[model samples]
Target: MPLLAGAATVVAVVGAVLALADVDSPLRGPFTLFFLLAAPSVAIAAALRGLDPFGRLLASVAGAITVDMLVAQGMLAVHRWSVRGGIAAVTALSSVLLLLVVVRRLRGRTASRRTS
Candidate 1:
């Protein structure tokens, strides 16, 4: 799980940089998608870590897609459909999700330490 999160973080960073650089190439779209999806995918996977491998995979993909659609819809409704806006929104959402996971893990560790 930690490894997955790390890889997702790397992909997100690379994708964001590529998007912001305005790279005019065939890779831009795919990288942008990776940037948008990677964090959410990690977050969802982390949150569902107890599930069987196949179930976890399915849930993570569905959750990530749901998050992506919601973000895009929100942007469309508010008329803020620009590359910067999209990047910012995806980053913000991913950050929040990752933070939640980190906080939960910290709390779990602290509680275990206290019990020990």
Candidate 2:
């Protein structure tokens, strides 16, 4: 599990760097696509810890696609559509979602400790 996560992290970082840097590598497109899909999916899955694994996976994947579409739509609506902008927006949104989940879990833990 840890190895999988570490590898995923490496892939995501590489993707973001390649995309943001406008690198001319064959790996960039596929890696960036993976990052775009994986980032929000993982964030959503973290928030939905109560669900069974399969259900969570399904829901999170759908949610990630929805997020990507929304970002694209928003950028198009504003007439500011660009690959880098879309990627950054998605990244920012995903980070916020993950951060909120972390904060919620920390609060829950603190409350449980206080009660005990």
User: In lDDT terms, which candidate is top?
Assistant: 2
Candidate 2 wrongly placed segments (more than 4 Å)? none
Each prediction's total of clashing residue pairs, residues at least 3 apart in sequence or on different chains, is 0, 0
lDDT of 1 by residue, 77-96 (tens): 99888887778887788778
Runs of candidate 1 with Cα error greater than 4 angstroms are 1-12
Write candidate 2's Cα lDDT for 1-116 as tens digits. Answer: 99999999999989988999999999999999999999999999999999999999999999999999999999999999999998999999999999999999999999999999
Top TM-score prediction, candidate number = 2
Structure candidate 1, residue pairs in collision: none
Question: lDDT of all the models against the reference?
Answer: 0.82, 0.97
